[model samples]
Target chain A: MMNTKSLYQEVILDHNRKPRNYGVLDHPSHHAVGHNPLCGDRLDIALNLENGQINNIAFQGESCAICKASASMMTAAVKGKTRSDAETLIQEFREMAMGERDLNHPHHLGHLTVFSGIRDLPTRVKCAILPWHTLHAALNALSSVSTEADNDPVQNAASHPEALNRQANS
Target chain B: MVSANATLAKVTPRINTILDTDKIRADFPILDIKVGNKPLVYLDNAASSQMPQQVIDRLVRYQTAQHANINRAVHYLSEVATLEYEHARRRVQQFVNAQEDREIIFTSGTTDSINLVMHGYGRKFIEAGDEIILTTLEHHSNIVPWQMLAKEKGAVIRVVPINDAGELDIDAYEKLFNERTKFVSLIHVSNALGTINPVKQMIAYAHQQNVPVLIDGAQATPHMTVDVQDLDCDFYVFSAHKLCGPTGIGMLYGKAALLEAMQPYKGGGDMIASVTFEETTYADIPHKFEAGTPPIAAAIGFGAAIDYLCSVGMDQIAAYELDLLNYATEQINEIKGASIIGTAAHKTAVISFTLDGIHPHDIGTLLNEDGVAIRTGHHCAQPVMQRFNVPATSRASFAFYNNKTEVDALITGIRMVQKVFL
Candidate 1:
């Protein structure tokens, strides 16, 4: 008995129609790109950080309504949060996504809880996580001190994508 | 002793007209169902055609009455199974006008058939630096196998480009053929665009270079009568599901010489003469390729589908479908924002098009609201989409049972999409 209201809420459609921070960031502290090759979904995320906390964040890409709106919601949610607190929120989002965190537990999700209905549609989980996947990549990029001038094959190959995510929290 | 056109004209009148939809609809219980409380307008036939009652009945009949493994047992039911299975093979041979039943090897479906050739034939002859010519208008199934072969073997894939009418550029194709061109693998008809290639003449040309031509007849087999002898293609593959049969059954027809020359694609119980720890001698022709307990019921059901088609007649089906295609083109073209892609003169009833300013996803959603089904996105032909310079298009593919009423529904649905979006 899933209502269309929960699935296609006005707020969600509003964010989808007019996404926030929908473009690339230039020479930012952290930058990453995530692609959902199946549906041709892509997102480029950039972060401006100050003293181990997120100061400003932006994202831009072309994607389905769910993904585009999710990105808009995510950037709005994470702005001005400490890196550690943002990581906690990422966990909260993940828990909400997997249903490990109670979708009905009103306090845990905050304003980002519109995606509770998305958890029911497995195909849409990826769309909801588009921004998070890119954010993970951006977090990873932030912690790496390896320079482009080094041109180390192992370092370069290992530094991007998964390595970026691993370094974020570690 | 006549041109292909003349032969087509001569055979047109004698075409079998077996199925009238008003009666045929009763055979398929699914057609009677409702979507959003409206009649289901099933236009996704190219993706997979619906099965008729005879095929379903035959499958159930075999399982209940004569269920047994084939060519491996000596008991009564075994013999019955073996005879029926071989008889089905014979039917397929005649259906495709193949030279012999031995040339027909059953596989899981079209993808499996193509994989068999790519692994079996491509590994054998397509060595390093050799080339395989494929069309831009192929399904991912056709494109991937050759790409896999090319990557491993260091062979290159040469795509035959399409013209404005969505037909292959034959001039560019002629230029691609040379000594290093090991094979030309082409789709008999495009699943996405509905463009039918002239495989007969192309095969003739490729054969002159002593290069074998492999035709993917997955789309063609369902829409028209395919005579492998007439096409003179080195190999042809198509699935039964797209031709009113159940899934998990497909046929791979190759020239006897080519079949004999290529090694087996898979290895298991039925394909072997005797298996030793060291080595095994493979079984002969078709069985050599058919490695295990094949889709016995599905194969038999596919045979039944052939019987159904033969009764209805391919020429009559083709003629009737042409009428629908013309009608659909007329209707679809009338919409202001609607523009049909792949305007090739000769095409199946597949109409891929874009509505001005509206996302295909939106269009598909609105159509579904009206109980109409249509496919959206790249349709598994990304290269073709790249060629057309569009991200995706909404497609409505037709089959024998689809009629003018459905076309009207589609037009109305499209206009609704326009109204909602525009």
Candidate 2:
């Protein structure tokens, strides 16, 4: 198990205490609410996309320190990046949280690697990943996302929109 | 820090000596194991308790000496297994003080027991326009089954609201009952808040209206003595795992008349007298409900768990746990930013609290670092969470085996959680 000390380091604590970009965007082009039903953590991600580049992003919700810190760091990491670059960061963060990618290997996680300790706690992985998942949903124009494995229609629709479309048509 | 230590030292000596808690702790082998470098302070008894060696030995004895499918053949092992299983039923009957052994039906767990009643009695009796009265304090197991029944039968479900103190609103509960009220199911104790509800009075009121009531005793049975006859409840359900027994086995104590009147929940071997192509005859009462080969070993372990609890004496257990609760509550109340959600006048050894500016999940993860295990979530009682207006609360539920020191560890752990966040 990763040291709990390392897991709740000063950087993560600072982000949780005073999360940056923490508010609703004014008439955002994209918005989604992320829900972790297992722990009752909810995150609202709203961002404005201008000319295929992320302009302004803000998050506000009731979540644990890990999730709040993740959201805070996530908003900072992808503020000025293009949509594709933001998606790549989301993918990398997911991999890092799930222990799919080794930190020793070259990656673009940057200072967000502070959350690398989350992989040791299976229950808290969703806490660290919910923000990224909501960001994914917001970018795709999905209104909501849930971490619940069984009833996550948002995940299915996002992963296979054509399949969902076919079903809806049928 | 010195004053805190001094206060703890003063309280430690005052801990109720009713149950030799140290001796009781020795029975549960898991209590000795270390979590990381620290000793495990397990305060999550409301979720599931650790089993004692006595119950473990009983399971081993049954599997090694008397392992066979019950009621199948005239073989020697079958008779022994069948006898032991029935003996376990008698133990359960005595445990809940049910009138007869036939009143106790072995179920998979408390959820299965509730679902069985919903299927057997609910599907058969409840009709459209009828109402089933439930409480906001109910676990999902007690609520969802009735919901499914209500949806299928076009029946309505009326919920009893709780006060801010987490106690059931008795006047509101009494008012919810009317001519349309058909059934009532409520929790004996709030698992999320540890409020010991006034169920006996509610049951009496339900009886006056001729509406049967089912008490979800999953949280109560582990703490106090529950006499179904004394309470006059129509049905009482609880899980063995909560009482330091094996999982996958629980008891549903229904009044014999109700059990006999209800349709069979499941149909298979052992629950039938005879089967034919055209007609099938079902067995009587308890056998009628216990369809397939039951969890023989788990049931036996459950009986052993009952035996162990009885030896410890439920009254003594209750007294000792109350002392622990008092100490823990006193300590937690002293914390600056922590606020307890459920402050009911009557409660078991459960404290659900939230630290200011820190979520319960964060509190739980940090506490685990100091080897303190607590439940941090909705606790399968979302209605209670919604009523309290919190996403979730960190809960520390105490069992008889837990001592004042464990409670102190939990308090220290909470302080550490605050420090980490700070």
Candidate 3:
């Protein structure tokens, strides 16, 4: 059996209890609400992107521990990165969470290795990557992200494992 | 010799055949399986129930020997299948005490049953500016369909509020009915909170105002006997799977006169008497509502499930489950920071609860490690959660087959969850 303890490590709990950048943005250039209808977890991602870089990124919503932790880690990780670099970091993180990449050799996802054990718990894989997918939609300027969408980004993650791997290796 | 006599004395009180749960548990084979290393303690019966071997055997018998299309063939298998299907309808009629067998219309499940009434009755009779009375305790299945009809027909929906204890306010429900009231659809028992609504009195009041009432009995039929005749509800709906039958089959019990007044919900093969390119004449009562080749084997399995429940008796089941609920409530209340959501004066064998500082999902995950199954979410009744000021709840619902030992396991599992969070 895979270790559930690894999935809910101390760092994850810390991030959940005192989440970083956990509020609304005043006037954001990019914003999107992500919803998982299965558990009624709704997350709104808002960022002020200036000069092709994320000036500030914050999120506000109600979600489970995994989602809340992932969103907090995401905002802290991508706040100083350019939009293109942020997208690349998201791809790498997706590959790691999907177990397509080894945790020992993560490219740029620093503290996000706390979620590497998510792939073993299939149902919770959605919770772990919900905010990252929402970030992807926000960077693309889509108004919303939904598991119910016909072409959901979550589905894309499962369908395009090779793409995630290619982006991770690059 | 002395020890043997003492053992007999200890076991004498638990030997009542009316609620012979030890014997009843042996009938369900899946109950013996282990989840991890721990024995499986299934408390998610409200979401769906475990099937007994009798129902499984009946399904196998239908598929092995009695598989054929009904009403369209002259073959022996077709006739046998048709007889079994209609026999299942009669069984449902007797179970619910409906006036006639023809009044039982088989659909996919409870959601499908409500959607049929929305399309068949609401679309036909409900006009613009009319009012439909619904309660806050309704499952989304009952709420969404009416909201769609209200949106399309320009009709208005008046919601009856519930008290803090999750019981519907009877005075508020009476006031909601006015001259514009065309219909009322209410849940007989709340699936989320397990509060058995005062449906009989509500039905009587609706009858006085000359409004037809539909009762969503999906949560009620499994826990108690539902008599559509005694309640005098115009329509009653429930799913088979919630009562230890197969999925993809449910029955809608509507009064014959009201059923005849409504239009057919779907147009297809079995539902039509004759079909031409110009016009199609629909079939009689139940057939007009049930379109296409229905879930035949499932219907037979539903009959078998009803037989199984009748053998044990619903009243016995109700009594045993109430004892289980009280034991579990008392045990759970001992945990520090544990709070139960629904505290209605009257309820079935369901307990929705929350622990301080631990998310419901986290609690559910930890409980799964102990092989104790409970549902954690809004329970498909977001309105109930919202009204209770909770985002979600962990619900452990009981069935007749459940024992006191399982409730002890649940309490231990909840304590483990709290310990991890603490």
Candidate 4:
């Protein structure tokens, strides 16, 4: 009751209101889609990877303000950064969203600190972090296709063929 | 002769007395509890309504006293369970105003009910060129079964479009039904949009074309009176749990003649009369469809629910619910950047709305803090959400037990969401 309004800080609202990297960009390179089937949130992420650096990024489709703003911020943050660094930031951001780290007590995890409060509510956790997950999956898929790297999938889904089939379909 | 305490009671009066909000609140024991450090204001009735003590007690009573498999038994417990089980079927017949008791066949839920029809009827009658018509308002439950059936039988699936208000284009639906249209199946009430579709009209239109209709009443039965005979629908299906009955119990009411003609959906113990291994004959209309052991205890509980609904009367329930629906929609419309997806003039309490910028999942969580529970996301109507060009929607569905106070709480929840995101 102590003004939950503060959770929607100016930066967050600004990012939502007039999102940077908004609309679909021309001649996209790394294009991927994110689906939140539970709540029907779908987003398409596209960007140009100039050499190893994510140069120009853009997205299309619709979602809640947090997801759109988060996507916007993500695209802005990753532009001009190396793919390796972007990958690390995605990991760090995931940790912050899981409440392992607080924004006030963090280094190397700068502006992504805006999302640290999302972990307080378990259900909303997915909404707050869907864009980040999408980015990671898209980049991972991009990297997998680009370099044809086969990383070890630490978790085994051998018992569930239906789930594997679903992933395959997705 | 009027007493102050009785007047102040929250429980709805059995007699024709005006309902008091405070009194009505006391009847539901769970309403007084807290979730996330806030008093629970459950508005997720479209997903499932909270069970009343009467329905819960019947379940317990069945488990304790009459815990025996019904039908094909000669023991005392079996007699009692069989009496109760058949009584449940009679109750369901009365609930939907079906012509005969034998028309009701117990199933898992609405989804299973639709599958029963598709596999049984669709397999038998529909050919390669026949079509099954659905609308954008359909839940995935109503959509997938027909899709599967069409795929299996070499039939096609045609979709009816919806306008900006989330109302189905009935003209388009009528247009889709022609010589090739073998059957029409649709949601009587939209779980996501809350549009109380004109199933009676749909039925009449399909009938003119000699096309049988199967209406998914999962979202409809709780709020309105459904008379299969009056509606002239070929088949109707609903889940008992949505109407305060136990989960895993539902009824598929098929016109006896159609059910008799359709091939048995599943062939097994109860559904067979004689088996020669080469030429096996199916049982009667209902028994032919029921196969295996049905949820006897849950069916008994469902009977209790029917009794409870009758006590309150469907007409009165429908009137009060319409009041709540109008109030909720009116208040939500006042919130800027909040868009209601389904604007069908005739609707139930289901309100699917989206705040311009906030994710529905976030809205659901913030609303939870205020003790108002609503369903968020696509609500299993992902295709419908896609039609509206939105990712998801925060849905609040109401029941007869809900009132202005709960509706007020819902508004306050939305305002809080607005404050948080805006």
Candidate 5:
């Protein structure tokens, strides 16, 4: 039996109710809009990067509890981290949420693993990953990102390692 | 509130006498299945309905005893299959009260049926500058095909707007017709909102200008009685899956003359009088439109579904479903911060609603934990969503098999959703 109660823990509910870093950043270095056309979840991620480190990060969007909470936690986790480190966290979070990364294996995901429940719900995996996808788009200076299979930047990055390298260098 | 309760109490006994919902529910095996340690409360009939045992048995019987490629064979199985398939066509023709049996063409489903007309009729008759009238209440199946045709032929597409209650603006619909208007396509019942459009009146208005009208009856046929001849709609399309039958089979009921005049949408085996490398003459009305080998078994299952529905009278089903809708409406309205999206004067048993702070996706996910299956999203009617300034809505669409107990379960599930969010 899939435990939906485990999915909607107090942490998630609290985050959804009073999201942290829930605003647009002024004079942001990177910004991107994320849309999950499936559920009409839309998120705008804006971050200010100073000396290759994220000085500030914020998100404002209309999304489901899973998505809004994921966005809230993602901004808190990546702020003040180096761009490479933030990118590494994004990769790890995506792998964990997709059930590809075994929790027994080494990872830096920490409390972010609460979203692992999303793996059981195939329809909601995109909800948990949309914010991370938007972060990747923001880091690469892409204007927008979508969770739709054809337009997903994360899937595009995985299938083409060369594209990931190109995006990182750019 | 007391008077409302009184009205509900008075209506329930009359409805129960008309239709024994308990007996009807027993015919569906899926309604007995448990989901996540809870009994399934299916409220997503607007998307697709559950098949009764009769339809399922029909499919099994066809596959086991009488399965073969239909037409073009003198083999025993082939003849049986062809006869059964054509018999299914007659059942559908009678179900919708079409004038002729030859008028019904089996397509993949509602979307495919609309596309067939768009290709066969629109492509031939509609030229540049011709206007096609559609409404905000249309499903994407009804709207997108016309939009595609308009784009391809440089034809103008006019839209009739809806009021806040999601009813089509009748005056606006009437005004959309003009000398330039060549065709009108609209939804009979809104899948998302449950608003039953005055399609008969609208069809009559269009015919005054000689513009042919096609009613997308996908959502209407399952819930109410449909009389094609009485409405005098030139074309009507619906899917069998929504009527407790198998998927991948639906009917497109076009007037015989119009169907004969239109070009064939697809050309292949079984839809030809004779084939030549240079040119091929198409067969008569229905076969000309249904090219290639159709889903023969599913068609027979559709006929069985029709028989099953006829056994449980449409009037009885409509009255019972209306009571369920009313009871649900009264209950959901009592919940603060939960607003029903479409509150039209006349509707089927569909309730599209929104919670003040909760997304419909979250509502749907939480409701599933309680085995309450609903549809949540734009419902392929983004224009309607935009009209109401909502991105998406959580919809609970009821069928005749659903009882008030399931509606109560849905209400409880909604409260559970609210508690989790809180």
Candidate 6:
């Protein structure tokens, strides 16, 4: 059993109510769509990178609170960081969400560490990481021939049995 | 005074037709388990029903005592297993009131059954310029296969629209039929919305044009009485897992003539008559569709589930479930910022709703904390969700085992979710 209070922390509820960077970005350098077919959580993430650093980032679409807040905090965390630093932070966040890294010592995640509660609720791990996944796809679009945001990589992860069963049970 | 007694006589049977839900709950062991220190209030019956001890016992009995492949051997276990397997087929045949045992084709589940028909019938007869009519309430299982067939055969797909209350627009359905309309496939009940389509009338309408129809009864069988013969549908499909039986097993009931006319969906050991180097022949009706070694234990468990349902009586189960639905709907209606979707006049015990400010996934998660299990998603009926203009909805589907107390818990859970969001 997990503590519901920990899972739906006050920070999460506040961010969910008034999510930051919750709109589309115009003339974006990269964009990608993340979808959780199980719950129909769809988010379109757009990023503006200037000189190897994230100049601006925004997201749009409907999703659960965990997803929206993660997107909100992720935008605030990676706003001025280099693309490589942003990738490292996302990897760290993913590891924390999946219970792979020590959540008690989320040294560099800053406020993103609030999502560490996802380690206790396995079903929500995908929700917490969905924005990061879309961000990863957006970043990868920088080097790819096609700039169209393709989130098939994230869709495959969401459709995995472990994530699907968790969504089904919830 | 005499009139009052007559009214009492008329209503006494219904009032007295109480389901011993506590006893029924006892038969299902999972209901006893707690979720997060709270008693489990399972309301997701439309997704998959929990198995009863009788069905579990049947599976165990099959595995321990009658374990053998059917129709292949002459030994004692083989003979017993074959008889039991065939006996389960008959049980399903009788449960759906099919005309003959041969009309029942066992498949993996409802999806497999629909895919079988699409491959067997649609691929065989449906050609260019043909139109297949479907309703907006169909689950993806009923929709995607037809879409594939239409795309493959150059056939046109016509849709029947629905009203705001989630009732099928019968006028539009009747208007869609023409000389080009070759077939109709409609859901007997909307799994997401609980709208029970007028399938009998719809089938009759299709038959008037000499077009055949298939009925998706996945959500109907658990909550209502289904007479496939009475409905006169060309094909009917349902899953056992939705009726308190095991998964990986379901039945497809088609008219004998249609089944005989159609091609077999798969080719393998059991479905063949004689295999040669150059040519291979097919077996008879039910065996022709069943390609390989089927889920023997699950099939026997499905028979036990049917027996248990019969003992409870479908009418009594329907009545008790209606009571639960009504109570839950009324309680849910009282919640502020909560609106129920799909309010069809004719429906089963399903309520799909959305909170004003809360996403359905959040509602589902919060409800889980309170041990009230419900389904929240597009429910594999994205068209229906699109029609309702919601990405997803939280659905609380009732079964005969549920009581008013559980409905109250659901209402309380919804309020708690609202509190958290607000």
How many residue pairs clash in each candidate at the backbone level? 3, 0, 0, 12, 0, 0
lDDT of 1 by residue, B1-422 (tens): 12323444556645334336777677777787788677999888888989988888999999999989998778999999889999989999999999899999998888998999998899997899999999988889999999999999999999999987789998899999888999888999998899989889899999989999889999998888899999999999999999899899999999998888998998898998888899999989999999889989999998999998887778767766777787898899999988898999789889999887665755665577678888877888898888888778889999888878999999998887665543
Q: Lowest summed lDDT over 10 consecutive residues: which window, candidate 5 chain B? A: B1-10
> Per-residue lDDT of B70-90 in model 2, one digit per residue for the tens?
988899999999999999999
lDDT (Cα, tens digit) per residue for candidate 3, span B1-422: 23323443454545534366777899999999998788999999999999999999999999999999988799999999999999999999999999899999999999999999999999999999999999988899999999999999999999999999999999989998889999999999999999999899999999999999999999999989889999999999999999999999999999999999999998888998988999999999999998899999999999999999998777667766777787888898899999999989789999999998777887787788899999999998999999998889999999989998999999989987766655
Off by over 4 Å in 3: A9-12, A24-29, A48-55, A102-106, A142-170, B1-18
Task: Candidate 2: list runs displaced more than 4 Å.
Answer: A142-170, B1-16
What class would a CAPRI assessor give candidate 5's docking? medium
Q: Rounded to one decimal, what is candidate 5's iRMSD? A: 1.1
Which stretch of 10 consecutive residues in model 3 chain B shows the poorest summed lDDT?
B1-10
lDDT of 1 by residue, A1-170 (tens): 23323355444446765676654433467767778876667776777777988877777666666777778888877878888777777778876766678765555457787776667656557867878878877787734322443322234435554433322110
Off by over 4 Å in 6: A104-106, A143-170, B1-17
Winner on DockQ (1 vs 5): 5
Candidate closer to the true structure by DockQ (higher is better), 3 or 5 = 5
DockQ of each: 0.15, 0.59, 0.34, 0.37, 0.60, 0.51
Supply candidate 5's per-residue lDDT for B385: 95
Name model 5 segments beyond 4 Å from true: A142-170, B1-16
Q: Each model's interface RMSD (Å)?
A: 3.8, 1.1, 1.7, 2.8, 1.1, 1.4
- What do the candidate models score in CA lDDT, each in turn? 0.81, 0.89, 0.87, 0.78, 0.88, 0.87
**Candidate number that wins on lDDT, 3 or 5:** 5
* Pairs that collide, model 3: none
Model 2 pairs whose backbones collide:
none
Q: Evaluate model 3: give its TM-score.
A: 0.90
Which tens-of-lDDT digit does each residue in A27-97 have in candidate 6?
Answer: 56777888888778888877778899988777766888888888888888888899999999989999988
Local error of candidate 4 at A121, Å?
2.9
